[model samples]
Target: MNFETVAPNAVPEGAPLIDVREQNEWDAGHAATAQHLPASTLMENLDQLPETDDPLYIVCRSGGRSFQVAQWLNGNGFEAINVAGGMDMWFESGLPIVSDGEGEAYVL
Candidate 1:
């Protein structure tokens, strides 16, 4: 019930950025540092997520999918926050984006 949208800059270093969009959508654009863990695959790879209970930023092209993923992550054990407005906002705000093979995809 304490869902909060983290500011782009507030995103800490080395925290996992969960991208819940489909592969095609992700290939078009995404936060460069975000991980390609589509929501469909999240439940299967929860073990790969960082152990910290802090908060992993869940994002998508829009807010819908990311919101669902965020809720599920909340029920799991890790603290998850949805990036409000999702990738649209991140891009509109002039934050960096990574297209298919255009830039770095992982932070660590």
Candidate 2:
């Protein structure tokens, strides 16, 4: 399966941002506009995926899980790309994140 991989800053504005991290990580912090679809629950919720010709952006704590998800989505006919440095890099790059709990938002 072939798919593109790009850094956090390179993800297109308003592209479907899929957060493949688990709930705990998501609760800690995630891109303000990201959709949480933890890799573990992805298959069951595949129907919820957005419809778009533009590439779907997948992110995890680091890059591993997102890479796997991007491959899977690509195999399933969606144009998906792995966010190369994942949430860590996104946070480091000063991107906005949302936190459900107390304290400063952090990439988990």
Please name the candidate that would achieve the greatest lDDT relative to the true structure: 2
Give the count of colliding residue pairs in each prediction: 0, 0
Q: For residue 50, what is the lDDT in candidate 2? A: 86
Per-residue lDDT of model 1, residues 3-70, tens digit only: 76776656677778888888878887888788888888877888777666568888887677888888
lDDT tens string, model 2, 22-92? 99999999999999998999999998888878889999988999999999889988889999989999999
Clashing pairs in 1: none
Q: In angstroms, give how far residue 43 of model 1 lies from its true place.
A: 1.6
lDDT of 1: 0.76
Poorest stretch of ten by lDDT in candidate 2 = 47-56
TM-score (C-alpha, index-matched) for candidate 1: 0.80
Clashing pairs in 2: none
Work out how many backbone clashes candidate 2 has: 0
